[model samples]
Target chain A: MTNENNSLAEKKTPPIYPVKTKVQVSIIFFVILGIYLFSMFWTQKEMVGGFSGAFENMFTVMEKFFPPNFGVIGAIWGPLVETIQMAIIATTIAAILTVPLAVLAARNVTTFKPLYYTTRTVLNILRTIPDLVLAVIFVGLFGIGLFPGILALVVFSLGILAKLISETIEAVDMNPLEAMRASGGNVYQVIWYALVPQVLPQFTSLVLYVFEINIRASVVLGFVGAGGIGLILNQQLGFYNYPNAMMIIVLIFAVVIIIEYISTKLREALI
Target chain B: METYSLPPKPKNSLYKKLKMIIITLLVIALYVWTFVSIDIDWGRAIERAANNFQRVIPKLFSPDWTATGEVALSMLETVFIAFAGSLMAAILAVPLAFLAAHNMMGGKIFSTIGKWILSAVRAFPDLILAILFVVAVGPNAFAGVLAIAIGSTGMLGKMFSEIIESIDMEVVQAMEANGANKIQILFYAVMPQIIPEFLSFAIYRFEVDIRASSILGIVGAGGIGTMIIFASNNRNWNEMGTILLAIIIVVTIIDFASSRIRNKIV
Candidate 1:
């Protein structure tokens, strides 16, 4: 075995790619220097107003945000609850819609080139626009309310959920899909029996993941006068009601963290 | 006699049932909490629906044509913010990722700390991070850029570490066996394998950052989102429409360019 290995090694030399040390170092130096210079130039010279001004203002800002009013939390409770419901409803709708969309988009499942490409392109375009932008547009059309928020969530989550679920679908055990097809099952039956079972865990996980993102995004949407906690938060900020804003921020942070923890645990189980 | 060999039904069925019930209740609680928080009035909502429809319909089909130039400039700012932010993230994440990788650091305490920091960073969404930075530094395009950088580092670090972890161990082993030092092993064995994936992910993140940067403007971080807010608030549907067009154009172009580049690299 040793003799054979030696002979093989001798017959076929391993490919070698030379590394140029000095050229690489110079390139790295130039890139770093360029970035530093660019950022320095871009930051407004007058706007920064040095460290002293920033330091003096910091105390004032902190003072305003102090003694967060817990009372406001209960008042905003209803809106906060609505925000989550919006996310839940939208996520559920998107998750259900994403099933057919994702299956159609998955290259392996769809088979036909044009249909696959078209579905993927649509998803890509959908994903290119941010959720906030979607909300802004929807709010313009629908007028500011929970409806706009929900519509935005549906579109936004559809983009992500579809892309993720399709990828999962593509990665599933193909042999089962083929076996079902071989057994004379129709397209729906094949997908149902084979692809659905294999990708269910990942699909559910992705849906939950999108839900988390949607919750956070909905808050931002609310800031733009679309109905939610963000709308109230924006109003407080506008009014310079820093204490109230601080309360909302704190509550949001706590809720976000808790939800993330639970979702993470659930995702682990699902996957 | 053969029945004795049959497998006993799974034990702890009661416990499983209890766990299921608990989970279902939690889901319900979560739903209830959200509903209560958002203050939805179904009756009022239904009443306002038609009025909303009347106000918004005219603006949908006919966008304002005049604000196209300003929209274009804002779009550029958005792209600039994303690019600059992602560039910073890519630069910063490289060393941090190397440090965070388990095998690279050889079970060092510093690596564990680095991993923890990255995870914490990843836990917060880019938008929330932007809000924090806007508060810290004052709201501006600069804050937006910094926010994207901070958020992107978390993701890029996570991906880079995973990439490093998945690299063929034999290559590094061979380099070590040949008396190559740590740096040599990194350059010669590790980087070549993961460079393509790293670049692709970075570009993908950049595309996402572009969209995010545009939205960050709504929070006073400078971008097209500011114009979007202005147009909407002023009830200038034409201006809003123009901005939307510009946004669509910019996004489509970037999306196409990035995908092409990613395909080439990966």
Candidate 2:
């Protein structure tokens, strides 16, 4: 190696990271890694058997999903429609609610530090609770139905939609907004005439993305007695109706694919 | 003064105007349809939710501190599940990412196939994966771990592949020019650059998994979710409040800690 590197080594300096802090960083990394390993060892009392075991279990379980019973699709119409409806309603409501929150949360728009940070922290708290947890809490409050599910979906999507739209708002060109303000425009006029035009397209796209998320999330919410196709799917799985479950999964896959394709095209058109 | 003559107003095409009107109408119709589909007694629902809040709000404000030890244990279990699962997924994702990365792999077909497979895996939500694992493993901490792993794998694989494809290829090319073997080239030229982002992503995923794993217990997958549901069943509002508070605190702490690390790394 010394013989091969002899010519260039003298002329070219070796690239190095910040070596002074390297040792400290390595120690912290190792300590964290050690803690994780220790915690996992303390927690696991079951057989994992690594990759080989995983493959075996996966294969055996997967075999039961073959030859999906398409016959059950007829009966699943109501719930499927119900799931779509839940997403539509919730997404529309969240999209509406997120507009104001996103503007308020955007640092450039709000200008006030306390208001901005508080909006961010509140958004974080809202996002940290996974949609399924929201559904669980809502379902607990009001028995299982589309109503609870819709409410959960609205709150869940609101947090994310607001966050994304706020970032978009922050990134908009500021000159127009500045011009409006310089002309003595009120806050509402500045937002409507200057800010709205720039942010509208991105807002619509984010809404679409949120809707896509809601569809997938609604399915999971159904597992916990919130109304949707997932609820039916869970019931089938609980009953050990593998063939029926397979059909529902297939239907969901198809719907998700179609919706994603359309949304992607629409987003491409917007951007 | 420049616009004193009143510049011609921008013309609005009739087609565009009609299209906008139609789109607005369609949006309204869709909203109406969604409302009709989810039939609700709104007045009753508002009354009921308000009443429930009256009973639940106080407990939420004053969490029952007695269950701190139990809450701590469950929180630990949640952290372990996220850590082990995300680590496992990160390790497994490396090879799949190599296959999917367009820069490393010349064959387009295989990369596309890899992408499609990842997307299919992604479509299956984490909870469903947990439910599937629970069916096989009889519901435990391990099942939750496995579920998180599978879900993380889908996302991590795609993200890692994108990272791999976007990396500066000059170093790798230089290593190739030096007649290094494939493994040596990857380890020497690529691994150094990719590790930081990979670590950042894994930590981010772990934070999300902690929140996710808590709810896995609702389906008997193991976490604090079962406690919340249990307290609700028993009408022990205070205990439920305590668990929710515990989750929020732990989640906030993890988010704060991880974001700091991620910022330093990236």
Top candidate when judged by DockQ against the true structure: 2
Query: What TM-score between 0 and 1 does chain B of candidate 1 receive?
Result: 0.87
Query: Which sections of candidate 1 miss by over 4 Å?
Result: A1-40, A43-79, A107-118, A172-174, A184-189, A241-244, B1-39, B42-49, B106-112, B173-181
**What C-alpha lDDT, on a 0 to 100 scale, does residue A118 get in candidate 2?**
96
Docking class of 1: acceptable
Per-residue lDDT of candidate 2, residues B30-145 (tens digit): 87887766776667667767878667667666778898888778877887888888888888888888888888888998899888888787778788788778766656777888
What tens-digit string does per-residue lDDT give for candidate 1 at A1-271?
8679868986797546345755776896698568645653453332475446655665777777888988887798877777778888889899889889998998887899999999988887788777887787777666668887888889989998999988997888889888889979998898788877888888889988998898778776787667778888888888888889888877776677677778889999987
DockQ of each candidate, alpha-carbon based: 0.33, 0.49
The C-alpha lDDT values of all candidates are: 0.79, 0.83
Error at B169, model 1, angstroms: 3.8
True-vs-predicted CA distance for residue A104, candidate 2, Å: 2.0
Candidate 1 Cα RMSD (Å): 6.2
What fraction of the native interface does candidate 1 get right in terms of contacts? Answer: 0.24
